[model samples]
Each structure stands twice: as structure tokens, then as C-alpha cells.
Target: MADTFAAIATPLGEGGVGIVRVSGPGSLNIMKVVFKECPDKVEPRHVYYGHALDASGNVIDEMICIYMRAPHTFTGEDVVEFQAHGSNVSLRLIVMSAISAGARIADPGEFTKLAFLNGKLDLSQAEAVIDLIKARSEKPLSIASDQLNGSLGQEIVAIRNNIKDVLAQMAVNIDFPDEDIEQVSCDEFITELKRQNDRLQSLIKSSEFGKIAREGIKIALVGRTNVGKSSLLNGLLGENRAIVTDIPGTTRDTIEESSSIGGYPIVVVDTAGIRDTDDVIEQIGIERSKNEIEEADLVVMVADGSTELAAEDFEIAEHVANKKVMLVINKEDLGMTAAQSDIDKLKSIIGCDTGDIVYTSVKTVKGIGKVRDAIERNLARGFIKSDGGNIVTNERHKDALVRAKAALVHGIELLEMREPLEVAEIEVHDSFQILGEIIGETASEEILDTVFSKFCLGK
Candidate 1:
């Protein structure tokens, strides 16, 4: 029998309400002892108004409590919850009362772990619960929610089923060598293996976009001094997050802020203008800017449209020549000093054959939308459309898929070489096992511990 586990489910702060959760066989018994005005037999799945009590039967707080019976609860066991005023002290006291009533404090993520162990959720769905909690934007939330709803697990199940069918065919060939059982030909087995391999490849391909959706992309604004980099940052965020001025080198350090474009989260970084400076502090800032450019997912090269291209502009362009770059010609309202010919010359100088160039005036906010669209387009280069399909978002899932793909490829090669069906079966079995790890069907205890340990308590 599992020990009853209790935890303060809400954050340790004041809110509208706080919840103390209990799960296991002893949950209702502990609830009966700790809640005042309790009936001899509590109705399952019904909320009851009551007051929490201490060992001396003194009222701890006015509360509402609910009891859910076994097999239908989060952990497939008896579960209870006490909802009380959102006071940290009161919540802790309530949890202590439950502890005194024979409910032990739960470890981090123990509740969800129990849910996984009890067959209430698969490994993927259990992992999705944490992703849902940590999601920072709607796109990530949507993906996580879909995974929790079993989209990814269903796809994995289908692939595994296909592999199982091939294994079955191989088994028949081995078990009935002299019988008239029709054996699966090498070509047929290879065809099925290749189909599954292609599916896994597609999933692996989606991981990049899924990662961007989950963690957001980092974009660094690079340019010479006084070219409206700060202004463009403000425009993208639709707020004044950076100090803007006509004086050069006003922003000596990088300023980072979070915003979303086209439903995707983005970290916009306003970097110091790239230039040769004698000031020690400015030099440090410029070095940091170079480092930021190196680490950025994309770089926006801001140029002054109101003035002719300078040596510094060319220097900046050359610095970011190999990076994924979008050229923004700011201050277009002031009249164009750098025309298309100048842009062509700048591109030639940078050795970049093609780039997204947007003409904008940060002062008038013209063409800001164009710049945003260009960013979205660049990021979506190889991104697979969602279309209600399973996307591999977690690095663990991607690694497993890669392993599975390699095993399948090896199996196909063996088949093409006319190796014994039994020999190729080993590789196919390995692929199946690798896929099973994704849903915890064959995962080791250590992997389970590592995954669940990242979850917050009471989840």
C-alpha cells in the first residue's frame, strides 16, 4: 500500500485561496480527522464547507474540502483537498495538521509521479504537465496541451504498432520454417521500416521550431552608434524599454526585453553600437555586443537611412556577414541618403548575396510591421506547420527519435545486404525499444527520477 502524501499545492504567498492536497489510501481518513464538522461518512466527489482544526480541535481556518475516491482521482487513489484563505502560515499549518493525522509530506513532483506510476498518465503526458506549467506564451501552452491530450503518445503508439507487425511476420517465418505461412519479403519489411524512419525524421525536423516555440528565439540588434537601434527595440516591443537619444554610445550595454511576434515569443536585445572607441567602458560594451551577436539566433543590422553609408556601417555588416541577418534601414522619413544602390554596395561589401532589407522610420513607426514579418519568415524557413500533428519538442524525445532512426536505418541496410531475417530483427527490436523509452514503457528508474525531479511539488 502506498503512503498517503500531502503538500501545499499553491505558491507560498497570499492569493485568493490556497490548496492543501492529499493522495493515497489514508487521504479520506486524514481529512476526516483534520476537518471539523465532518460526517461519519463523507460523500465522495462533493465539496463540503468546514473549518480546519488542530490536535486540540481548535479552529485553524474556515475552509472548503473535497474528497475523491480511488481509481478516478489524479493518482488513482483516494485524494482530498482543503481550500482555505491564502495565507502561507495557514496553509503550512493545514499541511502540518494533515501530517499529524498520518499524511506524509510529498516530495517534489511526487503527486504527478504517482499519477504516472498508477497508469493515470504516460511518461509523455506526465512530462507535458510540467511543460504546461512552465510555458511562457500561448504557442508553447498549445503544444504542451496537445501533448498532454495524447497526440504525441498516439503517434508513437502507431509507429510502434507498425514495427510490431513486422516483428510478428519475422516471428512467423522463424517459427514455421517448413509450413506454408507466407513470410514477409525483405523488400516488404524494408518498405515498412523506411516509412517509419521517414516519420521519425519528420518529427526530428520539427524539434527546432518546437524548441523556438517553447524557449523563444534570441535576436540581437547590431549597428553603428546613433542609428536608432534603441528606437527599433522600442518599436518592436511597443513600449519604451531602452534609453533612446541622438547622442552616440548612449546605450553602452545590451538591454534585453521579452516580447512576442506572430504568436511566437522573442527576446529582443538592444546591443551597443559597434565602433572603435577609446573609452574603456565603451570598449567593454562593444566586446559584449560581439559576443551577443555570436550567440544570437538572428541579428538585425540597423543602418541609418538619413545618412550616407559610412565605414562603420560596412564594418558592422562584415562582422555579421555569416550570421542569419535582416537589414533594417531606419530614419526613412528623414529622406534617403542610402538608396538601393548604396544597399547593393553594402551587401557586396558584406559578401552577403541576399538579405531581408526593410526601410523604416522609428520616429514615425513606419514599416515596423514589415520588419516583424521578415523575422517571422526567416525563423519559419524549415518549420513544419502544426496542423494538429505531433511535434517533437523535448530534447529527450528528439534524442530517442534519433536513436530509433539510426536503428531502423541499420535494419534496412541489413535487409538490403540479404542478411538473415533474424539478424535484421535484432535492429528492429532495438528501434522498438528506443521508441518505447519515449513513453516510459522501457525507461530506467534513473531517467524517471531525473524527469520528475524537475517538477514542482503538488503537481
Candidate 2:
């Protein structure tokens, strides 16, 4: 029998409530010994107010207890949860009490590990639980929730089943030579393989958007001094996150904040203004700003809409020439000395495309919405739609999908080349095994340990 384990499930802090979770064979018996119930008999699946007692039968803490019977709990084993005061002393005492009552300290992710071992969840769903916890944006939370609910798992299972069907056909041909059943036709084999390959390709493509949603897009704000870069960042964030002043060189370091625009999470970074400076620190900051602009996923090159474009502005534009850039003209309240035609001339001189220009005034908050809309439009250009089905989110899944697709494709190629069934069978079998690994049908112990180890203790 698996050893019973207990742990403080919640983060370590003083709060309204703290939870001590127990799972495995001895969970109920341990609870019965430490938890004094009002009804005396342990009621399964019901919460009851109780007092936790030490070995001496003295009251250690007042608590609430909920007992979940085997095969119905998170780990598919008996579980007991102690809801006690969220004080450090009270919480630790409760855990220690459970430990003394024949429970062991749960390792990181031990509870979830039990869940996986007991068939309560697959590898993907268990992973989604952690992803949900670490999700930084609403979209990511939604995606992770979908995965946790078995959406992604079901999709992988479906694809795996398709591969299994093909393998089954190949197996019949191999196992029934006396029946004289005709082997799978090359044309038919290639057709089905192409279809499955297409499906896998579609999923791989979905990762482009899934990746953007999972890892937020980086937008670096770059421009010459006194060009309203800080104000633009403040405008996008809807708060005075960056210090904005009439003085030049006010922001000497990068200021970063996360915000969502049109359902996309973006990290807006305001860097030191790009200009020649006498101050050593300011020059260092400028150098760093140049580096950030180059490495940024999207560059918002801010310029003063009211003033004529300067040599420093042109220089900043030239620096970001190869990057995905948006020319943002700030301070529209004062109007520009350069007309749209003049702006056109500056765009040519700076080598930025005409469509990338965004005219805005941060003081009045004018054109900020337009700029936001433009960003969303640009980011959404190549986004993948899931069609309400399986899409991969991590490197492991991607690798499995790639290998499975490769095996299937190679199998089909063999059939097309009129190669012996023996040759094609190897690739097809390899593909089936790869698919099995994704759904944990053929996963190794090392893979399971590495995945579950990432989970928090007590799940």
C-alpha cells in the first residue's frame, strides 16, 4: 500500500484559512485519530467542524475536516483536508500532528503523482494544473483550464487512435498470411497518411498563437530624448507607471509592466531615450536601450508629432531598421511642423514602411486606441485557430508530435515506393509508440518523475 502523506497545501502566509491535505491508504484512519468530530463517526465526503488533538488528547487547534473516500478523491484514494487557522504556528502544528498520526510529509507533487498513478488524470491534464497556477494572463488561464478539463488530452488520444487504426491494419496483414487478405494499397496508405500528417501540421501551426498567448509578446518603446516615450507607456498601461516629465533623460533605466490589449498580453518596456549624452550612466543606459530595441519582438519608435523629425530620431529609426517597428508620433495636441507628406519623407529617410506610422498625443490620450488596435492587428496576422480541438503547448508534446508525424510520413513513403511491408512496419510501429508516449501509454519512469516533480507539494 502507498504511504499516507500530508502537507500544507496553501502558500505560506497568514490568511483566513490554511489547508493541511492528507492522502493515501491511511488518510481516513489518521484523520479519525487526530480529528474529533461532532458526530463521532467519520462521514465521508462531508465537511464537519472539529478540533485537532495532539497525542495527549489536548486540543491543539480548532479546525474543519472533510473526508473523501477512496476512488472519489483527487488521488483516487482516501483524502482528508484540515481547514485550520492560517497562522504559521497553527498550520505547522496541524501538519506535524498528521505526521505523528502515521502520515509522512508529502514530496513536491506527491498528491498529484498519486492522482496520475491511480488513473485519476493523464500526464497532460496533470501538467495543465501547474500551467493554470503559473498562468500570467486571462487568456493563458482559459487555455490552461481547457487543457485541465481534458480538451488537449482528448485531442491527442484521438490522433493516437488514428495512428493505432493504421497500425492495426498493418498488423492484420502481417498476422494473417493464410487468410490471403490483400495488403494496404500504396495509394490508400499515402492518402490516409497525408490526412493524419495534415492534422499534425495544423496542430504544430496552432502553437504559433499558443506560444504568443503562453509567453507574452515583448514591446520595446524606443526614441530620442523628450519624445514622450514614457507618456506613451503610461498611456498604454492606463497608469503613471513610468515617470514623465518635460526634462530629457528622466528615464535612465528600463521600466516594464504587463498589460493586455485585444486579448493579448504584452510586456511594454520603456527604455532610456536614445541620444548622445555627457553623463556616463545615461550613455550606458542608451547603449542598453539600443540592445533592447534590437532584440524586442515589436518596437514602438516614439517621435514628437508637433516637432520636426531630428537627426537623433532618424538614427534611432535606422537602428531598428530590420525589426518589426511601429512609428509612433506623440504629442498630437501641438500638431506637427511636418505634414503627413513631410512624415512620408521622414519615413523614406528612416527606411520605415508608411503603414507602420501611428500618430498619437499622450497628454490628451488621443490616438492611443488606434495604436492599440494596430498592435492587435499586427500580432494576430498569423495566429492559429484551434477549431475547438487539440493544440500543443510545451516542448515535450511538440517533440512527440513531430516524431509521430515523421514515422507516419515515412511509413507512407515506404508504401509509395513499393518497399516491402517489413520496411514500412518499423516506421509505423515507431509512430504508434511515439503517440503512446504523449498520452502516457508508453511513457518512461524518468519522464513521469520529471513532469510530476514540477508540481507543488500536495498538488
> Which candidate leads in TM-score?
1
Worst 10 residues of 2 by lDDT: 381-390
Steric clash count of candidate 1: 0
Backbone atom clashes (below 3 Å) for every candidate: 0, 0
lDDT by residue (38-93, candidate 1, tens digit) is 88989998889989997667899999999999999989999999999999988988
List candidate 2 segments past 4 Å from native.
346-356, 364-368, 382-389
Query: What's the lDDT for candidate 1?
Result: 0.88
Instruction: Candidate 1: list runs displaced more than 4 Å.
Output: 347-355, 364-367, 382-388
RMSD of each: 2.1, 2.3
What are the per-residue Cα lDDT tens digits for candidate 2 across 168-284?
787777788568787765577677768878888887777766777777788999988888888888889999998888999999988889998766678898999988889999989
C-alpha positional error of residue 203 in candidate 1 after TM-score superposition, expressed in Å:
1.3
